[model samples]
Target: MTPRPADQRFDVVVVGAGVIGTAIAARLSSTSARVCLLEATDDVAEGASKGNAGITSSYYAAPGTLESDVIATSYRRWDDVCRRLDVPFRRIGAVMAALTSDEADGLPGELANAKACGVAASIVSGDQARRLEPLIGPDCIQGLVLPDEGIIDPMRLCVGFAELAARNGVQVRFDSPVIDIESQDGRVVAVITPQARIETSFVVNAAGLFADQISELAGGTNFKMWPRKGEYWLIDRDWGRTLRHIVFAAPLPDSKGIHVVPTTNGTALLGPSVTDSDRRYDKTTDAEMLAHVTEKTKRLVPSVPMDRAIKAFAAIRPASEKKVRIEVDEVVPNLVHAINRSTGVSSSLGIADRVAELLAGAGLDLTVRTDALDHIPTVRRLLLDPEPETLAALDPRYTQVVCACEDVSAAEIQAALEMAVPARSIDGVRKRTRATAGRCQGSVCMAGVTFMCSLAQNRAPGDVVVTAAGTAGA
Candidate 1:
């Protein structure tokens, strides 16, 4: 692979392209901060951000922490971001269902904690739970309803933020993994990567699971985070609306337990059984975990048949065995450490705003920025509207259905291929246009999008890759 030139510097360098890193990069770009976002993978959100259940959580957070503040505010902020980006989001509530006396008795503490954290949560009986989610097992004895909880497509959210950041002149470098952090006198000087060397004054370590390594590279690794792998199962779109909200089991010391989430893309997701693992990037879903997850999920929603599960995957959650760590590096004066929290997704946007505010407080002039960053992504009405006027207004390609399973049109795929950071691979196209992520799982549409990306990018089919590693052509 040819290395790209990095003849430019920036005010800040965010060393990860996970959900948190993307959000921070996008937010920081709103200022005069010349920012560069670095990612190890070829695309954003290929790590934990891609898999796992994509639920937008409330401050189900433990109270009196920076995370709680951001998580609480982010729940609302995410709703607005999703709207403006035309990213599909569902305001589906979440339920913490209890099936036993012990579980039911433990509910009050969760409710009180939620209230103390200023989250809107209520306790409900089995009948109420059934009424809220009719497919839930009749054995459910009690539950807590979190009305503001939501589900977001993580990849789309990351992509939207990236596109918006690019619109504001922030350079996001894919496949640029920071090899070293060049610093002097406990202040950031530059980030050294194989492809580019980004000179920066401030650095943000939002590398998700590998954040520890990035921190160590930057001369600040006072904390350590272990990876807790969570496996997930995806049901067919036919069972999409069977559940009105995200359903959960009460939290255990190890993990949040299994959840049944109806995603924004009209499909039901299950599992996410948390298990300790040493592998940082082990995304393989284990059979034992799958068996346990399938059994536990059936207890919550009996009608969800295991045979209908089309995809089972895994994501690693960064957890600290010591304590949740969120602090500016004491050793490094200009660096802020935001790493090792399991619920980072819930607090990502809020974390970005807080980091920016902190930098401003530290005498950084973050006020200077472009006049207005326009981020209104076009919503293709081809799938949403079949009316003649709507169809006519869209390029004639709107009439051409490219991926029938997800209702993705040729116009959408073409636009995705031509966007700020064009979809180079099949999964890139999937992230932008939802091409091969449907029930058929790329069996039918893979060839079409791959060929289109190859033709549009003027690359031979051999150059085209699918998903993360596998190749489709040549």
Candidate 2:
């Protein structure tokens, strides 16, 4: 890899390209700040952002906590934010179903918490729960209806934030991991990566899983970080179309319990059994855990079509002593720490605004930038309207169907590769266009995707890796 020219200067440097970091970068760029966003991988959302169920939660945390505040703030503006960013969001609402007396007992308290948090929620009878979600088990005793609970495409949200930030001239560096932080007199001055040393007025530590390392390296806070693995199954739209809203079993103190969630792309999600793991990057799915998840989810929706499942995967959220921290470091005056174990997607917008306030308080000029762009150009998806004659008229490549399962066309694949934060690997293309993410899971379309990636990225077909996880192309 080539090295960046030495010692580039910026007003701020955000340390990760996950949703939190990207959102912060996007928000900060709307200022006159010369910002830089650094990521370790070839593309964004390589961590928990890509792996988890994309639910933009609104009612999970305690009403008075920082987590709840951020989530509540973002929840109010979710529709506006999604519209401007062109991210697909569904405020389809969610139902927390209770099957036992103990579970039913918790619904009133949760409803009260929701009210205090300014969320619209109500307790309902078992019959009402079954009526709202026909798939709910007949055994459900009670339910809590949260009308503002939403779903969002985390991949697209991160992509949108990165693109908008880039549009505002924020320098985004991929494959650039911060190796060191240079500070003097308890103030951060520079971030050292393998390729460049970026001088900055302040640094935002939003590295997600590896955030502790960043905080420690900056001589700031001392916090430990680990992975809490959650495994999930993705079902095809055949079964996905049957679900009307996101379904959840009454929450456990430690976990949200197993959920039956629907994706924006018309697929269903199940499992996501939470297991505490010490491994920071272990994403392997377990047969026992998956079995547990499948059985638990069935309690909420008995006919959870396991046979229609297309994929099984796992992602780990950052777990630490502090569940969430969004404050300036005590030891280092200019190092701002932003960490959230879960709900990073739900609270991203509010977190960005808070980080902006922290930066401005620390003496950075965050005057709203008039020149920054508010939106990116929108593209008409061929698959969304796959009228062959009409689509082929707009672009010849629209006629060339690349992924039969998702109906993704060559035109869409080309356009994904041409985005501001372009896809460079087969997996990147899948995230952008869903080419290999359908029923067959790339078995039928990997070659075509590899070819398209190779052609657009200007590499030999064999040179492109099948995934960012170092799976070499065959």
Candidate 3:
């Protein structure tokens, strides 16, 4: 690992590369400030951003709260942001079904919350809910319809932010974990990593699960973050194609309950059983938890094809005493914290704006850059295009499909490898191009994808790893 050149000072250094941090970095890039985004992992979206349900909820937060405010603002801006970045986002809407009268009684409260938050919501009878989604279980007695709720690709969302930030002159340094935050006279001075010592007056602690640890290094408030694991099951696209909208059980006191979501890429997402745990980085799924997920999901949408389940994974959300904390540090000057449990993605754009405003009020320059790029070229996906012959004529590599399950071409893989924030591993390329994320789960296309990655990295096929420090030839 080579160190960043000496005397590289930045106006602001943002820690973590999750959706929140990347969003802030991207927003800050619009200014003339010299900004740098630091990530402990080899690539972005390696934490809570990579896994978890991808729904952009319209009214998940309580009214008059910071989360609700951000969610409302983000809901309005999400479509434009996705279009500008060329990321996949769909406004398919969502239905929260109630199987019992007791549950139905809670619908009024939810409807009120939606009204207070300015989110469009309506209460529908069970038959009306069935008309909206025929596959909903017969046990559903009533439901709440949220027409603006949608799903998005979390990987593309984070990657687009980072790529756009990089295009606008924001330096992205991967594999750089902050070892210490030096302060003098109650103000941040420099950030020390093993590979570099960056001089900066301000630092934003958006480190997700490790935000508390990062704050401690900066001598900020002592906030503890516990990990809450959410396990998910990915159903095959063949079954997902039948589902027209996101279906959910009524919200519980402590959790959102299980949901059946039709993702933007045509696959269905289910589960996310919230379990309180002490382990900070435990992402392992258990048989018992997964079994509960299938049972609960079936209760909501009995027609869901559990037999077509293709993958099971887990993500850890950062649970804090305060449900969400997004404010400048009280004790440490020039330091900010953006922490949340499950609504980070849905609230990211608003979070970025608020963080930028805070930085400006704190005396950081917010001069607009005239040469900043506004958009990046959308990667050409064969599955999305209607005429393959037209694309094949432009680049012969477009015709050479590498991952048949995903219809991903060699050209797309190579294109991802050459992006502003280029892919460094097979998983990186998967997040960018969906090369090996299909029904087969890479069993059929792993070899071809690995060979391509090997060629891209100038390494032998046997030595290729899925991600940084991951298993070779996985």
Candidate 4:
């Protein structure tokens, strides 16, 4: 791989390209500062941002916590942000059903917390909850209706933020892991990657699972972050219509419990069994855990078809010693630690705004850019409207279906390859274009997708990776 130019400098260097980092970068791009977004993975949203439940939670936090403020603020701005970026967002609402008396007893506190956080929530009887969501099981004794809560396409949200950031002149560098943070006079000077040393006065540690390590590298806080693995089962789109609302069981003290979420892309998702782990990179799902998740989810929403599950995946949430850590380092100036676990996606925009404010407070020049692009060009999905006659007339490649299951056209895949933050691998393309992420799960489309990826990357089919760093051939 070619090394990055040694003399490259930026006003702000953001570590991690997950939702928080990308959102921060996007916000910073509106300013005159030269910002750089660095991601360790080959593509954006490959970390915790890609997995887990994609719900924009509104009432999941305590009253006086940062999570509360951020989640509440993000709930209001989410739809507008998604609209501007042309990302899929739905205010489908969520139901936190209480099946037992112990769970029902917690509803009052949940409602109180939501009220204190300025979030509108209502405690409903089981019958009312069932009326709202007919699929909810008879075991539900009570429920909390968080009408403002919703789901989003996490991949699109991250990509849209990165794309808009790039459009506004933020340099997005993928596969650029911050190996070390060079500091001088108790302030960060530069972030050293293997390929290049990015000279910047300010560094934002949004590194998700590795935030603690990044903090230590910056000679800042001695915080410890353990990975909390949450596994999910993505039900087929056919069952998505059956589940109209995002349903949740009563929360555990440690976990939010398994959820039944209807995603924006017409798919129902279940599980996300929270299990604490020491392994930062362990995203493997356990069969037993998944079975437990199915049982728990089924109790809340009996209609959840476990057999229709198309995919099972896990994400590691960065569980800090504190609930969330969003503060400028006291020891290391110009280094902001923007870390959150479960609510990262929900609170991203709010956190971004706060981080920018912190950066400005720390003497970083943040003059508003006169020419900053507010909106990114929306990529038209041929699969969304596969009008063969009309689409073929517009682009000949549209007629050639690459992924029949997803109705993904050759033109769509080609367009993903040519995006601002172009897809580098088959999974990248899947995230961007939904090419091989259908019912087949790349069984039928993997070859074609890999071929397109290979063609785009100018590599042999054998050399092209289907997803991440390794797993190139098989």
Best by TM-score: 3
- Candidate 4 segments whose C-alpha is farther than 4 A from its true place: 1-6, 382-390, 471-474
Model 4, 318-366: lDDT tens per residue? 8888767788998888899998988899999889989988999999999
- The 0-to-1 C-alpha lDDT of every candidate, in the order given, reads 0.79, 0.87, 0.89, 0.86
Per TM-score, what order, best first? 3, 2, 4, 1
RMSD of each: 2.8, 2.4, 2.2, 2.5
Q: What TM value does model 1 have?
A: 0.94
Give the poorly placed runs of model 1, Cα more than 4 Å off.
1-6, 322-324, 368-370, 381-389
Better-scoring candidate (lDDT), 1 or 3: 3
Residues 1-474 of candidate 3 have per-residue lDDT tens digits of 343444689999999999999999999998988999999999999889999688898877789899888787798778889988878888999999999999999999999999999889999999999999998999999999999998899999999999999999999999999998788789888898888889897899999999999999999999899999999999988889889889989999877889999988888989889988889868899999999999999999988887899899999998899877889999987999988788999999888988888888888999988888877788767877778768887788998898887789989998888899998888999999888899887888888888887888899888887877674554
Over the full model, what C-alpha lDDT does candidate 4 score relative to the true structure? 0.86
- Deviation in angstroms for 46 in model 1? 1.4
User: Candidate 2: minimum summed lDDT over ten consecutive residues — where?
Assistant: 379-388
* lDDT, candidate 1, 334-404, per-residue tens: 78766645666777788788888877766677875657474657656454454745764558887777798
Which of the two, 1 or 4, has more lDDT? 4
Candidate 3 to truth, TM: 0.97
Model 3 clash pairs?
none
> Could you tally the backbone clashes for each prediction?
0, 0, 0, 0
